[model samples]
Target chain A: MSAGSPPGVVLDPWLSGVARLVEEGFDQLDLLTAVDLPRDGVIEIVIHLVRIEDHAHVFGHVRLPRADPVLESVTSILPAAAWHEREIHEMFGVEISGHPDLRPLLLQSTSGPPPLRKDTPLVARVETPWPGAVEETTGRRSRRAVTPPGVPPEWLGEGS
Target chain B: MTQRCYAVADRPEVRVHIRDLGLACCAVEFASAIARGLLIPAPEEPGTAAVLVISGTVTDALVPEVVRAWEALPEPKAAVSFGACSNSGGPYWDSYCVTKGVDTVIPVSTYVPGCPPRPEALIDALVSLVVPV
Candidate 1:
């Protein structure tokens, strides 16, 4: 539960620890965010508390059951945490139970699964990586010529 | 800085009022061109002499906005698909939100191709607008 270095402990349910950190004079919520670990079937939420006066940083990690993860909003403790909570709700699909405005942040008005989820497929076509072989003179074989397999040649010609 | 006016009566170097519809990285180049005086912002109200210069990976959410802007520009309006994103989905062609191309939504007069076209390259496209054959 404790941080890797300095000194800290991972609170079972960060809701209370968020309050405890505020009580200990860590007035600034440096960052509140979550990560999607599909392999673990959990969303890991991490909150960082900073005391500018002492330049102390305390990071707390909490894992929620990805199937139906939920957590109390920390906005009550740190209003600034509201945006980050909303971000996690959308990106990691973690439910911030008491968030006043869980409305979309970076994702404009749209509905879909969290884009950050490990399993979430990239919706955009990435650039075709440069092929390692220098001279790939177009002489068709089984597949297309321009880009190698796995790389889309959609960007190759005037049209796909 | 080049000036272009598409006025039928006066043709006083028509100002290029560009309504930028950004989808991704190319928006940066679009902004830079504006800084170089290659383009100008459209008036507060729609239906002015303008071009809907779309760049980057456009998501499905922005289709209606593009249509609305294109319809609003006063007659003699043109569209410039300024990046790979708009010409095709660009690299993001595979994305769920990215629209395959701008031509699907509106007529494109000029197509500037690049992952994110450079400011100078965009100037070339803008030049095509301002300069007459």
Candidate 2:
């Protein structure tokens, strides 16, 4: 319930929330995205819609359990949500049940945990040593290199 | 050991065709190069494409295709790894899907260092590739 945050809704009545927004003249689906909150153990799906006539904006948010994130497809109500939903499905691993085409929209494959999931490590950072970790020599003592951001300290063990 | 000799073509109207693979943000610089006539666009067909100018991030998914394009080019071809992404994945060096560098997939003749290098940098890389000092 933060400032300017969208009204919250549960997963069960997902379609009805969207239907209500559409009924209220929110004709355009501007954006649909998901946020993976690993600490909170939930994935927040946020959808933004706009009323074409008045340019009024509306946002709807639904939180799903991180372990099993599934939501009813809104493509039927708003056709424009197809691509955004596809991206959400691909990136966040949130299953949008009943979406017509759920193929890999942008990525080459969906072989592992969807990339956007907080648990999924950005492999590039892990595999390659961060150049910033190199010690820089000043006039006196050289500065110690710190760990790369977002990467778990334990993952690198002793010396990164 | 036998010395291998290449027969030089005496065609005065010869032009080096470029296969521009604009993958990400650096492509804006590549486009700027083209818009400014700093780079000559590749023909509709890749047959005459002599230089493969890889500008931007090379994702793992595009590795095979990038290699395929490089292999498809004629002999005596060159590849210019343009921008920091093509050179070493730039800021996306830590991205999950981005390939660290294009050189890991295909051989590169020149590397232009910049997040989005100036159009002149691309021209300079091309010139260096054409005339080996």
Candidate 3:
């Protein structure tokens, strides 16, 4: 664990260690999220926990292989973690192993890849090209031919 | 070729009861127009309205719903595609979530052009639509 991380354990003893934390009164699961690193070939699943008795908090995480990221569900200990697990699965394609109901929690459609992955395709982009200068009607200076963003030059140019 | 034209003052209201289906940024103006009585809100009953006013960017997911709304209106019905988005998807023409133009889904009697057409222009459209072509 980093100096900034609270009392936590590595993947070596994460579940049992956190279960022990629950006994010590860190009873609330504050957050469960993931970060995808395509370059490093690992997807990091981060979780934050809080002790309701005195507001003590800690952050923990486990890294999964990027090819098929998967993690055992924590809902057996913190049932509240279910929705967050489902969201992470839907967004980042992280399979939450042993989830009772791993169905879609937010999106109704299932036509494309998980949306939050860094590799997810963009449906729309307005990257217009910078045209070379042409003679200006005002004669002040040559100016680039302007077109609306997202429109390609071929559509604006004369002839097919 | 020879042509003939006819005109008649059929309905006493001098206007078609407009059934509005506004989806995005243009909904605010549609509500404002309805509240101001510039456009008569059609009754809930199907096949009663004479015009279907579509304003805003409609996605492919909502295309079937739009067609259902159009089919609900009575015969001799006219449709107005308002704003740039409905005309050609405005700023999101290339977006997969946005339909390129409303005409691809429904026949249009008139198209009002503008990102969000000025209120004066909308009023002018209303005046022109008062007489069916």
Candidate 4:
């Protein structure tokens, strides 16, 4: 893992390479994440896969043009990656082909374009402060916090 | 004999705690107590323990670093995802670079929820670790 170099093996004919990885049974899909490189006009999709025996990881990268970034979904082969892929798509606007359900995993209908997109400005919102908490100097309010895909927010709180 | 108490070194204890929590590494402040050995290694006894307190943005990019740090310590430890980032990824959750929670990369035994948990809360989590499930 060199500095700034992407993780995992670089396979030519990217889509087929991922299909081969799937066939090899290194199919435990750990995570699907993306990086937005606005300057380059592309979004880099990173797929993390693990070997069941020792949890050895292999990453697969696909560079998609920002204008029409799309890739085949691995959900049919690895169900666990479904939500993760959906998250990447919702956040980065990278379309996943062959996905059974391609709906917004996060973001309210009024929230405008994909917030994680490189071009999106970091806007602040204004909201009431909690009791006894000091008011923030910045007028912008923070985004509402949401529970992670698998865990509940209450589970991370006191009672749970 | 009079008893004396010293602050434990934050880095070493954090390393040990991560292992117990089933994490591989962490990004910590490296408090002087950890460097000075005030925080003794847990005895060889069956249920020895410690705590790993986290705050701010904890994402996938930081996972490998945390894992590497945890690998350098001995086992039978426990972790306390002591703040927002450790428990829920805090303000960074929606961002592409942040992870959902430390639990995504490492196993967490207890979550001490707060933007930054009180030191007393951290101590309580450590006590619980030694007391058994």
Candidate 5:
């Protein structure tokens, strides 16, 4: 079978869309994850549902604005979405309203910006002098130090 | 590095109780080693545990808990940074969430180096700690 795009559903109707799929025999929640789209200023929520009887699959994508990324909790309908929603909330900074227990899921720090958000700088790389950087300079004329990914150049004092 | 005598008086007979802080994959290796008799599992009480084996990545969030675990052990207690992650944060040294090393949070007497050091390596580290030869 050829691959196809999952049907996109707006945030307002996201809960209903998932409920409809469940009613249509998609009983298993195989995966639920989020994609950070900085350029588009949106966070994409992707979900894969599986039907136990025939092993059929259904996919749904929901776009949420970066500024106000909030969605009604799907735990009431899928139950298993609780952990996934908690992870998304912590990493992507997306708020999952009405979640029974939306406490911190994985990450220990709650002070820093959501780690998975596109704009969150990877502080560890910035603070710790990378050992590999020393190895690169030992053999020959060293190239300009490249800023680590997810860290803004200005934060590293590389900006004029 | 403040030097302290780690050798227990009754080296061979004294059961080296272990307070396991299994955070990640190293915990799996540690457990396997214990199950296969490569390493001995000791008493559950932290007061009796001579060694606090921190097995895996030590994150900044867990710093307080790690420190508390170390403090709970009785005097002459030693800590083992079980794997590379706990040693120098392993591959997660650059991870925003991971603490560079477990030593940063607690005093570690021995550091077993490996992505997940073989259980035999852990046994060797513990032997060196108690026997002091």
Candidate 6:
């Protein structure tokens, strides 16, 4: 953990430095996750690793610019990173260089924009009639009718 | 012996609970019937047939417990992972407390795909596995 940061340590020189660390120290790459910081126009990628004895569990983070977020793939260094990096790429559109295969692991090919992107708007869920149920349109806003429980009203539709 | 079964809609019941709890720490109530005897045996049977229902905070330590429980079960059993927390490890997947998915610990067969799948869906899954085609 870095002195200034909350609980995470920020790696300098970003992807390259982290790749070197993975190569030299940790042989096993456990997992990879990303945090979208749209406010800063950057995405933070966290890489976790553990040694054989599980004594040394370390994490490294790299921040990529949102404009063209790209980083070196650690799949070569650690094979487990393949799916993790693919998920990150699909969700955030982060480019991973030298990746043996870079494809959308989760999202469908025909799906619209990335759902997890910070700027992408969330869709509202509409409850239609089962088979032949009538569509009820009252004086109330269509947004409210389709709004599912627990889902934010704002994300449902435009404010009426 | 007699068996009792309950059914609930996947839409309103399951999704509502999942939303209430959030995927991070959602808890799905397992029908006591299934939990009483479901077991995960060894990996020798090619495809380990056992459903590992998971929810709440899944940790690395929890993996061993699940594996041990599964290993103790009889052969030719399948796993039905109910709830988002169990299937994809839910909101806590990326977090430090949760594993990405329960599959990391034990093999999974069917993923119910909800924070908590409706009782009806759970029943359907159970029936599909038990009832022959």
TM-score of chain B of each: 0.75, 0.79, 0.76, 0.60, 0.82, 0.60
lDDT per residue as tens, model 2, A1-160 = 2223346443347888899889989878888899888777888888888899998887788888889999889989899889999999999999889999998898987897788887777666677778788777676785665888888875565225
lDDT of every predicted structure (CA atoms): 0.71, 0.77, 0.70, 0.59, 0.78, 0.57
For TM-score, the strongest prediction is 2
- Residue A31 Cα positional deviation in candidate 6, in Å, after optimal superposition: 1.8
In order, the candidates keep a fraction of the true contacts of 0.83, 1.00, 0.33, 0.00, 0.92, 0.00
Q: What is the RMSD, in Å, between candidate 1 and the native fold over all Cα?
A: 7.5
lDDT of 5 by residue, A41-108 (tens): 78889999999999888778888998999977899999999999999999999999989998999987
Residue-level error in angstroms, candidate 4, position B39:
27
Per-residue lDDT of candidate 6, residues B1-133 (tens digit): 1112222232212110111111233343454323442211122323333333444455655667666666665565556666777776575444433566777777776677765566455656655555565
- Which 10-residue span in candidate 5 chain B carries the lowest summed lDDT? B1-10
Off by over 4 Å in 4: A1-3, A11-14, A125-160, B1-133
Number of clashes in model 6? 11
User: Taking the candidates in order, what DockQ does each have?
Assistant: 0.40, 0.60, 0.22, 0.03, 0.58, 0.04
Residues forming the 10-long window of minimal summed lDDT in candidate 1 chain B: B1-10
Off by over 4 Å in 6: A1-8, A125-160, B1-31, B34-133
Q: What number of clashing residue pairs does each candidate have, in the order they appear?
A: 14, 0, 0, 12, 0, 11
Worst 10 residues of 4 chain A by lDDT: A121-130
Best by DockQ: 2
lDDT tens readout by residue for model 4, B52-109: 4444466565678656554443455445576676687666544545667877776777
In candidate 1, how many Å is residue B17 off? 4.2
Candidate 2 regions exceeding 4 Å error are A1-12, A130-146, A154-160, B1-15, B37-49
Best by lDDT: 5
Against the true structure, candidate 6 reaches a TM-score of: 0.47
Q: Per-residue lDDT for B35-121 in model 1, tens only?
A: 665555433444445667777776778888778878876665778898888998877666766788989988999899887788767
Using lDDT as the yardstick, the better of models 2 and 3 is 2
The segments of candidate 3 whose C-alpha lies over 4 angstroms from its true place after superposition are A1-67, A71-88, A104-111, A116-118, A123-160, B1-13, B40-49
